[model samples]
Target: MNAFQGRVTAALADPTLKTAIDRTTNTARSKRAAAIAAWPEFAQARELGRDMKDHVIANMEYYLTMFEANAVKTGAKIHWARTGQEACEIVVGICKAAKAKSVTRSKSMLGEEIGLPHALEAAGIERVETDLAEHIIQLAGETPSHIIWPALHKTREQVGELFRAHHTDPGELATVEEMVSSARRNLREKFMAADVGISGANFLIADTGAICTVTNEGNAELTTTPPRVHIVTAGIEKLVPSMVEAMTMLRLLVRSATGAELTQYTTFHAGPKQPGDVDGPEEFHIVLVDAGRTTMLAEGLAEMLRCLRCGACMNHCVVYRQIGGHAYGATYPGPMGSVITPSLDGLETSQDLPRACTLNGQCHEVCPVAIPLPTLIRGWRTKAWVQGYEPLHTAWALRIWEFFALRPVLYQLASNLALRIMPLFAKGGWISKMPLAGGWTRYRDMPIPQGGSFLAQYKKRQAAK
Candidate 1:
């Protein structure tokens, strides 16, 4: 097995990880259902959200240009990056120009996508993650396993232990609250002393040039408000035409993300602090990263762009709950990740992702923006097959199976022969061992063939009747 498959096997065997995933995702799914059911107009709202996103994607250039112009008008510099490397360079250059030694950051998936934390570290700048979950993972030297809840895979005991090792005065932090307090105390200094603050925007308004972020812990507000220089890194697809349009999306976002009516803090930072503003950054920069998004749009995979990043798809994904996000081995994980990863990283490297799904359509059912995730995953599989990305042995096996499958008489003869030989491996009507099928039998027993094939048995039954 390859590295990805090996990781998946390892994850499945980790009971603690599986338990964490099941509990957290089940709660999220239940809460989301309750919240959506409470809203009578949710269906209409979802349809409207889909339509709005489709419109923006269709006229992406116009909205993007408008946003840049308005953002520049508010004294915020707009930087465009066609790739992750360019985005990282732009951000690092901004920090270098500001002579920044440290940066306080909120939770930004786009940052994770471009490996921004590593990039900042390489430039000899201290990166402090302000979000609680993100800080926990950062202290543990681990990547986020979930989009909204970065430390979902970690238990409270695990977090307490991690804090005990990393935080000052480990003796003082015995409880969850104490650990949180210790983290806040440590991060408060970082927030004030940092030369630059980096954040991610959930949506960017084209008309008013505002960068909006919704957070439950309010860390994003501090991340954007403090420091001399502030940088917002976001995917190019996160654009809305107006505040009104954004509000509709936000309604769907909060409900789908945390199953709350709204997050605690829904902040809008419009082009840094104004002249009279008492508490705000001195400079603001927005780095829009394409990084294969445009390629996805060009290749008719634009539907994936409608994703709000709410993560509802994964919450309801059977495979995700079984093995968790780390098993996927990608920046993004679960159902949505299965589709997007291949699009961004290419099918050759991420081929296993598409095939990871059970294609139960639960992901599509739970998706707030109504993206057909299962269909898109299937599209990637088709692309893989057409491009000959499948393994040589598997490909040859399928071809041989198909040849017999297309011929009824030959297929029946083959099945009869297989049934006659089945007793060699069958034990108590279960095939515990099978040649060339160890992958399946290794996990669970396959039932032995009882009597003749179903087609042949059906003919015998008809004759009997």
Candidate 2:
């Protein structure tokens, strides 16, 4: 078995994983549905968001340059990193130059994408995750499974155990609110003592050179405002034309992500503290990491750039619900991650991701910006097959199927014969096992075909009509 399959097998064996994923994803799915239903102009907003993203992607350099100029005018330094490692190095260098000893960070997928935490640790800087879910995963030394709900896979019991293991408190934590209060009390000290803070940008406005951050917990505000130096790490594709368009996208983002009208705190950092400002960072830096995004834009995969980092697609994904995000073994998970991971990490290393999907199109249906996730996944599968990444057995099977498929008469005859022959092995209208097709029947029983091929059934109905 491949690495993904191996991980999936292990995850499946652990029933608690699926149980946790089911509860969380179900709630998220319901909330998103209700939020979308409540918004009368959601469809129009989705189209506008899609068009705006497409426009920015078509003129990526223009928006990026505009953003850089405006940000520079505000005295905010812009660092361009072509790769994840370079991005990590830039953040590390900034910390070292400022003589930062402790760093507080908000939950940033970009930071995780570049392995920033490890880089900071390697640089001898103590890093504390200010976001509660991020703090939980950080204490456990684990990567985020879900994008929005980072530690959704962990139960409250598991969280209590993690806190008890790390924290000085030996009291039994019974409730989530109590756990939150404990974490808040613990993180407040870290926030005050932090020399620097790092965060992710939800949207970077080219007109004003401001980075938009949306969070429900207000940890992002605490992380950015308390620290002396503030660093924003984000992908180049996050650039928008202005706040007008940013608000439009934000509307779709919040509802699609967490089923809320808006997050509690939506802060924008243009630059360092001004002459009249009271509490703001002395240094403001924005690291625009290309990290394969430019390549994706240059290639035909620019549609994937419209992603808002919302976990809506994954929340409704049946496959993701079954195996959970850890099985994907990437920074992003679910339908979006299936395409993003392979697109960024290369198809050779992540070829199995595209094939893992069921092509149900629920992801495409619920996507805020109307990304054709299944279509993109199909493109990845095609690329993988063309690049000789598919297995020899699969290739042969497809070739044999193609031979009959090209000839309708042969295809129909073969299908009818198989339909007739397969039922001979069925017990009580279900096949428990089959030779050479054990992969399908091993996990679940396949119902015996009652009629003939679809064409035959259609013809019979037409004749009767």
The top-ranked prediction according to lDDT is 2
The list of candidate 1 runs beyond 4 A from truth reads 170-175, 408-438, 441-465
TM-score of each: 0.90, 0.96
- The lDDT per prediction is 0.90, 0.92
Candidate 1, residue 399: the lDDT equals: 98
Best candidate per TM-score, number? 2
**Clashes found in each candidate (C-alpha, N, C closer than 3 A):** 0, 0
lDDT per residue for candidate 2 within 1-465, as digits (tens), equals 888889988887786888889878899989999999999999989999999999999898899999999999999999999999999999999999999999999999999888999999999999999888899999999999999999988988899999988876635578888788889877878998999999999999999999999999999999999889999999999989999999999999999999999999998889999999989899999999999997887668899999999999999998899888899999999999999999788899999999999999999999999999999999999998889999888899999999999999999999999998898889988999888778777657899988778989999999999
Clashing pairs in 2: none
105 Cα displacement, candidate 2 (Å): 0.8
lDDT, residue 285, model 1: 97
User: Where in model 2 is the C-alpha error above 4 Å?
Assistant: 421-432, 441-451
Please report how far candidate 1 places residue 81 from its true position, in Å: 0.9
Candidate 1, lDDT over the whole model: 0.90
Clashing pairs in 1: none
| Backbone collision tally, model 1 | 0
